[model samples]
Target: MSEGNHSSVTEFILTGFPGLHPEYYGLTSAVLFFVYFLTVVGNATVLFLFATNRSLHKPMYYIILNLSVCDILFSTTTLPKIISKYWFHSGAISFTACFIQMYFVHCLGTVNSFILFLMALDRYMAICHPLRYPNVLTNSTILILSISAWTIASALCSRLVIVAYPLPYCASNIINHCYCDHIGITMLACTDRAPYGFPAFLTAMVTLLGPLAFIIFSYICIIVAVSKTAHSQGCLKSLSTCSTQLIIISLYYLPRCFVYLASNVGITFNADVRIVVIMLYSLAPPMINPLIYCLRAKDMRESFLKQFRRITIPKKGQVSALKKS
Candidate 1:
């Protein structure tokens, strides 16, 4: 493509949930809005509970706090615009804005992957090596690991953004999905994208698979250690402790792997189906994570309830005034 053509596209139009009937737009928008709202509230509740409850300040809860922050940020970065697109029919995004969205969407995702890996390690240590767990995952170490997750994710994603930023988008300006992403945006560049595409793909795979491998290994070790104890009750308790994290890990990684594999292997899925699957993995986890932690982790649930009661209880003066009335 000529330079003139390359410079033509200043913005891109996002085609969200293609192949859907026009009548369903309102319904889809409403659902997305509800999900986004819940995501924000749920994650915020977790953050608030974590912040106010000093007893909750430990390595596990610290990691949960980080994960909560990541979930909130990730949902904020992607959902509102897509909701606008569906609700208001405002789908055009400036070129720079699109790239910014693409960057954060992937960057937060990478951070979440690493956070989950860290959580898995936390669990493994707590379960498999209880004696050394506290020493190994001290508060300082947790802070460093949390910071490192964000830093490493940013550094890795920055390379992709830097490489894709200058590429000329002469081919088309319509992103087939709800939001701008590395693959969707890069495929629109008219230049030979192989140079950028291959590296980005490789980075993505490593980002997705590397921590996943560690998480799996950690869980395997956990299972083995639990099994060797010869106490069924102990084994059950250990599995119960790890179950929530395992559910979240599966939710975070499996659909992503399936989507990537399906796309690369020439397997054809309906466009709408593909987009919904993407949304499930990307959006659902953030919305469900807080619930999982609160419901599955006894400590978190009790702390939240204790805080709620403190907030809602009537003062002694108010109780006397009510009796007088």
Candidate 2:
């Protein structure tokens, strides 16, 4: 594994969940397929409702739409290959495809963090600065913010990929994770990986923690403002909104923080246990987000019910014709 004898890796064999028992591969693949199905259906329902309903064309719904799209992209990027690996025993991935997956995985993740932060900001504006909320979060403003999130996330992730790609991956080509990622792939490099690893780690922390800090601050201000309101109903309503956002935020960040701490502080966890934790944090949010965020909204719930009825209910003429027949 000397630097002088370094050779480029062409493909990688993904050892997804090495601790998973071979006897349970079928069961695990089925469960993953079910989760992936739910993720797609839930997020797609949210996106379709937003796209087709003129009533949901507001700034808040627009942000939710963006979030739904991100969930779909994230789930698509990570889940299918793992499912294929478990079900069909197909785990070989080309070097180019691995890096491509790594790029989108981190890129979408960064985008999601910023989107959640933006959501908190939107709520803060609506509650604390109601008079200026409309002007502050106009369509144009939201568009610019969303674009900035994608652009900045892509740029930072691109740098990480660029730094990691050219390094000599002369050692083992087996990635011990479900998919390609900065840490999982970079660690396979033959030479001193400190130069690449440190920057990638730093970037990951900033991407995850920076938005998290802003989200926390935003919620604090929101809670303070809501507490100062005279009406108890308004306070309850505001608290309810903030609570949902906080739950989603906690689900997304807490497990990630735990993993980082455990890995860095020498806290040992079984390989399967660690992978399960990662999957839960990464996949659970996307699967349940539509329920937490969209279904929780009174208007959205009502609209969805109404839409469902429209699709299921028969026309008056058709009902009469059926009765006559």
Candidate 3:
């Protein structure tokens, strides 16, 4: 059979997990539901906090909101369907649906990496060039930059949707993962090389390595600049910003390298290992980003807590009054 003429696999069997007995479905379903629910609620609260708190009307929080949005999209790309399939025992998705999932997963993932890079750059500018910082990263400029990030990400990932869609799908449709992943779906391709291999590598590098290098380099410059400053408070403040960003960047970037970049080298292809790595790379960032910034950053914590108290104290008093009456 010629490479092109080889009847293309219509779908893939997702090896989501080792087969669970029917009895455990209830327990697994409950657990997945709770996890997805909490993820949604946590990300939604961060977005809401970023929006309503006027004190948070700064570049840092704006970047955070962007991160939260990306995280929500990131989680949605796979987790929801994965949860459904395992829980229901009928987690079948069409060829079209899988391609769409693969596209957005990469697109949002690329945007997330870019957003983090921008966040690092913003910190660097704020510390290294204080007076000019406001002028340089103005609201208009951030808006333009954020738009540019998304546009570039979309353009980069557009190839996946274009290439994956045209291939003929046949009887083999079981996707090993709960949702459509590039690595998982690409394994099933008849052409074997073009539909999945080259584009995936190119996009992974653009999405993962490029942004990580920028973030690390930006921080290096910021650290040097901060050391030169004579002002104690300025130095401390700069360190604080860099520290928060460093923590998040380290956590997010490493897993991405392990999952996407390392996978390219054709390491041991264990499905379970792949899922765990993907979860860390995908789910952990959004989950911890708000925690890092809100809990660790003093001003953000104070602002978030103060706002929470302001909104909640009145309701508490009203509840007490109602109980007394």
- Per-candidate TM equals 0.95, 0.94, 0.87
Once fitted onto the true fold, the runs of candidate 2 whose alpha carbons sit more than 4 angstroms away are: 1-8, 261-268, 315-320
The predicted structure with the larger TM-score, 2 or 3, is 2
Q: 110, model 1: CA deviation in Å?
A: 0.4
- The candidate with the higher lDDT, 1 or 3, is 1
How accurate locally is residue 81 in candidate 3, as Cα lDDT from 0 to 100?
Answer: 78
Q: Say which candidate scores most in lDDT.
A: 1
Residue 83, candidate 2: C-alpha displacement in angstroms: 0.3
Which is the better candidate, 1 or 3, if ranked by TM-score?
1
Which has the greatest TM-score? 1
Per-residue CA lDDT of model 1 for 1-325, tens digit only, reads: 2445458898999999988888988899999999999999999999999888898899999999999999999888898998898799898999889989999999999999989998999998999889999899999999999999999999999888888888877767999898989988998987887787778878888989999999999999999999899889989989998988888899889999888777656798888899989999999989999999998888899998998777667576688889999
The runs of at least 3 residues in candidate 3 whose Cα sits more than 4 Å from the true structure, single-residue gaps closed, are 1-11, 19-31, 194-196, 229-237, 319-325
* TM-score, prediction 1: 0.95
Which one wins by TM-score: 1 or 2?
1
Model 2: per-residue Cα lDDT over 5-106, one tens digit each: 334567899888998789999998999999999999999999888777888888888788889999999999999999999999999999889999999999
Report the error of model 1 at residue 123, Å.
Answer: 0.6
Q: Poorest 10 consecutive residues of model 2 by lDDT?
A: 1-10
Per-residue alpha-carbon lDDT of model 3 for 164-198, expressed as tens digits? Answer: 66654543566666667677776665555653687
CA lDDT, candidate 2, residue 66: 86
